[model samples]
Target: MISGETTLDVRRRLPGVPAHVGIIMDGNGRWAAMRGLPRIEGHRRGLEALRGTVRAAIDFGLDYLTVYSFSMENWNRPIEEVADLMGLLKRFIRNDLGELHKSGVKVKVIGGRTDLKPDIRALLDEAEDLTRSNTRLTLIVAFNYGSRQEIAAAARALAEEVAAGRLKPSEINETLLSQRLDTAGVPDPDLIIRTSGEKRLSNFLMWQAAYSEFVFLPMHWPDFDRHAFETALAEFSARERRFGRVTAQGQNGKTKKI
Candidate 1:
């Protein structure tokens, strides 16, 4: 928890809330391990984390919140665990879609859908359709997402475009490649936060997060409360986003830009 802070103070302290924030939710299995519970149970508790994240992001005035729900490599986990995760995802869609829709949270699953069960796919479609036009907030779930896979898919798309003579090979610039990504229309994340002390990207949003400010927290994903989110936002607000150029406030506001 932030020390000696009021809600009003926190709200007043924002230089500017980011338009987009990405999260790599880590340590669910470890969290469960610590409690002597099954890894799947850890993922269940992680859903609680998801609930907090959704509401907190909305409260923080973020336009988009993208969560790395499941990576492509996660398929290597035990089949029972995978089944449990899929089951939980299905349940969330069934039980929470109405509430999410009512709150104007647009749910989008951005990744390969080929390997998912038909029922899960149907739930995703239903959730997306129900909240398609929601403007309050957009929540993107990167299930079975891999940055390399995304890049490969983009390359394939480009190849097809070139083969059809719709685009010149030389015309495939950065923007063209970005447009082919799963997050095509969405703005790149201004801040990427990973909870439970991990420092690696673990193959999340590789191409899009070239300049994103990163925050790593020691708290487990299930333990990430609103205060943890506020702390992250506070940390972000303190930094000068110079992109590549040095800013007048330097990066952390302690040193002056020369």
Candidate 2:
């Protein structure tokens, strides 16, 4: 749970805001371990954080938000934990899908769909379909996602297109590859925030976050709040994204894209 703070404090602390935000929800299990709670309880708390994040993003007027829900590597966790996670996920969708739809939040799930059970997969499909026409915000959930595997899958798809004469070998370009990625049609993340102060990408989105401004928050996932979000957004807004070249424009705070 986040510390006690008045609403006025959060409003006063709000600074630069971001339009597209990505979060690596980390430290749930560690938080539980520190509190002597069951690991699944940590996941539950993380879900609570998810609710907060979604509402905050809406309140902050963010256009896109992506969360690392279940990575492909997480399959190695204890079977009981994995099952419990799935159960929680199903319950979340069942309880919140209608509300999310009403809120006009578009939902999309990225990564391998084969690993999920039929019912869960169906639920995801339903969620995405139900929210396809929504325009309020885009919420991407990366489940069974791995950066390397996503890139490989994109490569394979491109190769197939070439073999089928749908695409010339010379037609393969960054744009084509982007369309092949699981995040096809989605814009690259502008701000990537990782909780628990982690600095690594951890196979989240190698291709998508090629140049995202990063924020490493010391707070755990369950501890993050609107204030933390505002802090990260402010820091990101203060940065000058040079991409790969020096800005030819005078080094004034004005953004001059390379």
Model 1 gets an lDDT of 0.90
- lDDT (tens digit, per residue) of candidate 1 on 1-258: 289975534743566788899999999999999999999889999998899889888777788999999999999999999899888998888888998999889998899998887887888899999999998789999998999999999999999999999999999899999999999999999999999998989999999999999999998898888999989988988888877776365556676554
Best by lDDT: 1
Residue 154 accuracy (lDDT) in model 2: 89
Question: What TM-score number comes out for model 1?
Answer: 0.90
Instruction: Give candidates' CA RMSD values in order.
Output: 4.6, 5.4
Segments of candidate 1 deviating more than 4 angstroms: 1-14, 248-258
CA deviation > 4 Å runs, candidate 2: 1-16, 248-258
* Least accurate 10 contiguous residues by lDDT in model 1: 6-15
Candidate 2 lDDT: 0.88
- How many residue pairs collide in each prediction? 0, 0
lDDT of 2 by residue, 37-65 (tens): 99999899999989888988877777789
TM-score per candidate: 0.90, 0.90
